[model samples]
Target chain A: MRCWERPLIEIIRLSVNGDSHEIGVPSHYTLLETLRYVLGLTGSKQGCDKGDCGACTVLLDGLPTLSCILPVQEAIGRQVTTIEGLADPDGPHALQDALDLTGGAQCGFCTPGILMSAAALLNVNSSPTRQEIREALSGNLCRCTGYTKIYEAVELAARALREQRPPAEVLRS
Target chain B: MLRLHPYEYHRPRELEAALELLKEHAGDVMPIAGGTDLVPNMKHRLFAPGHLVALKGLPELHGIVERQGEIVLGAAESLSSLADHHLVRSHLPSLARAAGAIAHPMIRNQATLGGNICLDTRCTYYNQTFFWREALGFCLKKDGDVCHVVRGGTRCVAAHSADTPPILMALGAKVDTASPEGVRSVELDEFFIADGIWNTQRKPDEIVTRLRVPLPSPGLRTSYQKLRERRSVDFPLLSLALAVGLDGDDRVESIALVVAALGAKPRRIGGLETLAKGERLHDELIEEIARQAYRQSNPLDNIIVDIEWRRAMVPVFVRRAIREALARP
Candidate 1:
């Protein structure tokens, strides 16, 4: 099929991490590109630049999605949560701290995506079994850590969240 | 960074407007629900549609409703939502399992049922970056002249990778489509064509609106089994879907056995009804059914696994699926 000529760029208005932003981008631009390039939220890595890798994973309307394949126009008016959004001004999110304490992030390339996936899981089920954690993070491939530490980290985070304790405090005790 | 070629993207709030846009653009336009498949293909330059009619925002294609003894699934329903839907899990667990089994959780969260059903057939020779495909001199499915899977063959042999169609077909599902002319419903079995290049009968101007699955009768049991390389995101090397109904006497009254990912379209094994009719669930009968499935399957060397191995696994999967379906209460 031939290309249809249209406006060179379109303005997209969406809420990312509770902040609303209006950005001009190509209609075909993926959410990953808009997040990393335009908005400067580079936590979501562009691993495969395809749906195969979940390194560009982020939460769209509270569900984990592969931002690399998601068109930016589709995210219009939707709530997008990236790894950077996961942290508070006070400190890192419990999951991030748990990953750090558990050595879940060796290379740290896949950690952001894994954190989002795990965070989505915890949103629904605060206490997920190891199998559930494995299934939830199956999309995020961590080549360096071998997933054992990552699974432990998610479990640790879940426990921290359930007990209403900071991950750092839990790890210390 | 792999990027999509510049194209006009149109997101219509209403389904009617979307259909009109499709009709106006015709051959130049492609309706994209989830870009999980199409965006990657666009990156590979396999398809460069001038206009993409985004179906994501249309509220019409976004709900799972139960009406008149049928489950109506909106075409744009995300795979993750469908898998987790209570009705799907309680009634059609096989479909939920199939949807959950697709790609990964992240992809499932974005990919939709309509997109998965209309997923492009895949081959080792066809799915590649533009540079890689150019270096190898594209195959029949793309810009090439010959079929690489079968040397000297005239037709493309890419395998269908969707996990839902076979199960949907076996469960007697129908797909609804809309165009400028009107809206029509097609049985899932009749929707798929047995060619890799143009696999579905869906017209360019038509958009799949919804999938209607007739509620299976009591005593009707179903199962879906897929064999893929990995436990995560890999597409099925071979898949078997079984739907069987038992009579009051516990004899098989109706049976549908479908094998997918072995060819361009999911093939329903012929003579299954006759062979399984009035037959009791026994070792010999199951073995005979599995053998029939093995005989009916035609696997090519286009996908990842060994051709012969895939062919041989058909019976094994069929047997397992049959047992699983029969075992389910």
Candidate 2:
């Protein structure tokens, strides 16, 4: 270990979901804690608190990352997109609607993180194969659905995004 | 919810400042690149550093550049980026594969190459909650003295579980490190020591800043194969990395077979050079190589699976890795 004397608390600014937030937190607080406890955004779940479970997955600079292990200071100036940021002015994103339609979320504990991961995937590749979707969501675990419905939901959402059709309209068909 | 032990955190924007801080706080501060490994260990009370020097956003330790005939990888480069980098994919696909296969996608996003290379050895006895370890007598790696893995043993036998070191060693990569003293480069093969307690040769104040992989010559082939409990998120029970260079006549010219996760350090088996060099690779020769790897592997009962079974799987994984590397055009 190196020797240094630094203040325990630091004021860090973050750009989260298009909103800039300035918060004073201890350096030890992870981004997950800042988002859930301090900033009052509880969309991301803390399943493992380690990097094992993807329940705390969030998009940092458009890339899905685990916020549990990321220090708040590391995310100071980065763009953080949580599950709460997934919805638009209209309603839930297409992926959320697809999950609702397909009953992809059973316990819903891991839903937010899975949604963030899949959203990041769709944001990059609007139309992805089933295998690609599975690969993209490999980090996210769904113990309840057995991952069948989640895979179907991602496929449905991909089609909805590709066809520029509302998720409700796609589900109706 | 497991909480980290509180400590002063210093985010140094400059590499020089980070090194200086490390030099000043040589015995009290730990450098953190991605907290994927350190934070979890902190939760387990494996370490309680007084201060943490954050290495994030240090321009010196961030980038993958192809210089001259080598791929210069910044130690701070995330595993995700390294896996997706075109240079790594084209020139060192085995490294890319190993990078992608580590932990999971989110972990790969936060974990860096240097962090993985410097990842702490693991044992079931050592990686538990503080209360859990307290209830049971602690092992030699941490608080208690007796080694739980090797009963009555004098030292720690925690297995090295990182997925990159063996592959890097197979590629004959070198790492450049920085300290207040100066910067020095060491071959990856010489970086790791055999002891589980004092795993690497890195000093307290030194920080691994970059890894340089020499560009493969023509006819060079490499592959990395890892066997774990699950495909999603588990450390490798056994991993084999094979790098073979075939002569124009299709005979093995140069070869390196490194088996990891079975011991404290990844070791390159010497039997391959003795048996397969300058010879056309055949099923019998491959079998002999696998047998040698199996004999060299020394798995302990400290990991998830049965020790005997993990030991037996060494040859199987090595055969597969060798076949895969040879099959690639």
Candidate 3:
């Protein structure tokens, strides 16, 4: 295709996790689309498409953001980490493992978003109670199973990290 | 899912530049604050502005400060910042309580106090996505001809949806707006218009720059109470914010009581002052005040939850808000 074939909307190159893209996006394309489509990081699901459903959740500069509605241009100078970035390619995030062990995930459309939200929550609060977990995960929804397992998973992850509290081993090495 | 249609985006550092843009562009431009309300509404296709004048990068519009015995909160200060600011927590505790109760933690981090103050008066018939409205036919607030919420209605019946306005009104806040007409301060009570189509007293070109609040006396007490379906991210079904103080012998010195989600703008049931004069804060007095609140309020069935439940609870919310105000010793 020729350069003139597509509308030349200005874009700031975005680096999500380790990958980078010089994609041409319509001014309205959100960070969620850039991560899921241009970058092929499927871990960031499109749940609500509005900010309400945390299924599109990711960390913008280490704080959880609903990527679905976050303008891509707003991500111009920010760091974005998706759920895929949370774990080593070899395995799942300890939170994810804890989720499985605790049966935290049921219908998994929300799993990726919930995992990222929990990862951010767990990083900030090493000793979150069920109330904190509930509040933190309010943006994300799990309809099939109630919130019991999810709350338990957060507690387990907190304990795991507290005992050893290793710096998250997933992204760099 | 709500999507932002393509629009021109301009970031101007100065307030005058922003107001100039609004003037030149007029109705075509929408001012972007925290996007707490505007962004979501935009996604829902409730609005389709050709330009978005973003205020986030503006240096002049981002602080919470106290000066000359008054607290001036920047129009763009995030709710989280206001909720956490010590001056706000001290002088305007009811306002602080209301701000903290809005939406949720993340929203509070991003929703601006001014953004909530200027929300389009919402009607249940009016707040839905474009597609949802298409299915049901549109109402008076946006695209359609008839007011779905009020049959045979000549004007829109959208409820005042902002959570903070009632609180700010009760705190005796004033808005400072800058337009090509120059700057002016309007008492928060006057800032709202009862007519639903144009709910705000502000001209389209004016930008709310700062809100000023007088310092609270040590004896002044305040409280805020809201009824919403969920603890997070839902607009208020019925809300009340009240501030009260007593004279030398604990009689009602002055009172500021405001209600939201019921009408076009927060209405002051200042009638409570007459009811409270010379009377000690008592269950019977509170009951009268609550009854007066229900009597004064006229809620319509255009939003989520029942209109009857909302009307019935007006007194409850009023009593609770007044009780909270009394509890603020």
Candidate 4:
């Protein structure tokens, strides 16, 4: 559509996962929509379509935020980190590998958001207690695995990140 | 996928420009801070403003400062920041607990104090999707004439579910608001009205700037008890904020017990000072006060929880809250 065709269109420069992209989206589009639909970073699932669920979680300036409710324009100048940002050229991120090892993702629908929340927690607290891990991931609801394995995965990931080694080594130890 | 109706998004660097936009847009504009509540409400079609004035990170509304025996909390400060701020944790522990207790951690990262204070009243019927509400033929809180919660009732009885207002009111905080008419400070107790359609005294053109919470007295003991189904991410089924100050002789010097999530306004239990003042906060006195609170609180059917059960929990929570306050160092 042309500019005059839709006056409500806003062209926002988004910084997601260390990459900047200038995209034009409807002014009311949420960051979740802008990411999944516009940017094609669908790793962040949309669960409740509101702030109640953490499925649409992303890191806005490194803090876990509900992107489903966050306006895309609000994210224009901030560092937006999604699940895609977690892995590197070498392999899957420690959290991902740990999840696989612990059978954290049964349905795998809530994994991305869980990873984002756990990542935000581990970024600051390299050694978080089990209670702290539970508190950090409280927003995420995983009905499939009953959250025991998810907690185990975050613990393993935290250990690996602290030891500066692969999660497999940390798990074996 | 629920989506917000298209609207103009405005980011004003200064408070003046924001006020200008609010004035120009009048009823068509809303100042969005966290977008935690408003966005979901918009998705539910509760509100569809033509413009949203972004208020997050505005320098005029962003800091927690202690001045003149009061702690001034910037309205736009995120709840997590408030919960973690050393000054807040040390000086206003009840407020910290209330702020931290709201929603889950991620929501706390984005939700703001001003937003929580100005949170929209909620009801099971009113908070649902348009289809759900429409199927029920709507209610008085929004787009309908009849109230489903109270048959033949004319007033909207939607509950005020915010976690911070009860504590703030019990603490005697002041909410500062700015508009085209200049700034005004109102006691947090007077900031809410009983009408659930819009419970706040805030006008369309006004923006909450900061909250001034008087520093607690040295002998003041405070506690907050929230009754919710889950430990996190759930609005309170019932919440009580208790603050009691003891004299050197262990007699009650002052007391404020505010109960919320029952109605449009957080009701401060009357006759508390008369019953508590100059009296020892013993088991007998606590039990009497709890009975009085139970009698005073009238839990409506607005909330999805069973009204009788919720009513029963009032006294239980009151006793627990009082005990918690007394136990506080």
Measured by TM-score, the strongest candidate is 4
Q: What TM-score does prediction 4 earn?
A: 0.98
B1-329: candidate 2 lDDT, tens digit per residue: 88877787888889899989998777888999998999999988898888889886799999999999899999999999999999999899999999999988888888999999899998889889889998888888888998878879987788889999998999899999998899999999999998888689998788899999999988998989898888878999888898999989989989998988988889888867868889988999888888998888888887979888888888888778878888888
**Per-model chain A TM:** 0.94, 0.94, 0.85, 0.94
lDDT value, residue A47 of candidate 4: 91
> Residue A168's C-alpha lDDT in candidate 1?
80
Residue pairs clashing in model 4 are none
Instruction: Rank the candidate models, highest lDDT first.
Output: 4, 1, 2, 3
Instruction: List the candidate 4 regions with Cα displacement exceeding 4 Å.
Output: A1-7
User: Comparing candidate 1 with candidate 3, which one achieves the higher TM-score?
Assistant: 1
Q: What level of docking quality does candidate 1 show? A: medium
Ranking by DockQ: 1, 4, 2, 3
The DockQ-based CAPRI class assigned to model 4 is: medium
Q: Write the per-residue lDDT of candidate 4 for residues A1-173, one digit (tens) a residue.
A: 32223548788899999999999998889999999999999999989998887999999999999999999988988999999998998899999999999999999899999999999999999999999999999999987845999999999998898889999998787
DockQ of each: 0.66, 0.54, 0.30, 0.61
Q: Which pairs clash in the backbone of model 1?
A: A3-B50, A4-B50
Q: iRMSD per model?
A: 2.2, 3.4, 5.1, 3.4
User: Cα lDDT of all candidates, in order?
Assistant: 0.90, 0.88, 0.78, 0.92
lDDT of 3 by residue, A1-173 (tens): 32223433656688788677677777656788778777788888887676666788888887777777666766766788888788888776689877877787887889987888788888888889888888888767776755788888777778777875432432112
DockQ preference between candidates 1 and 2, better one: 1
Candidate 2's displacement at residue B218, Å, is 0.8
lDDT of 3 at B165: 85
**Model 4: DockQ score:** 0.61
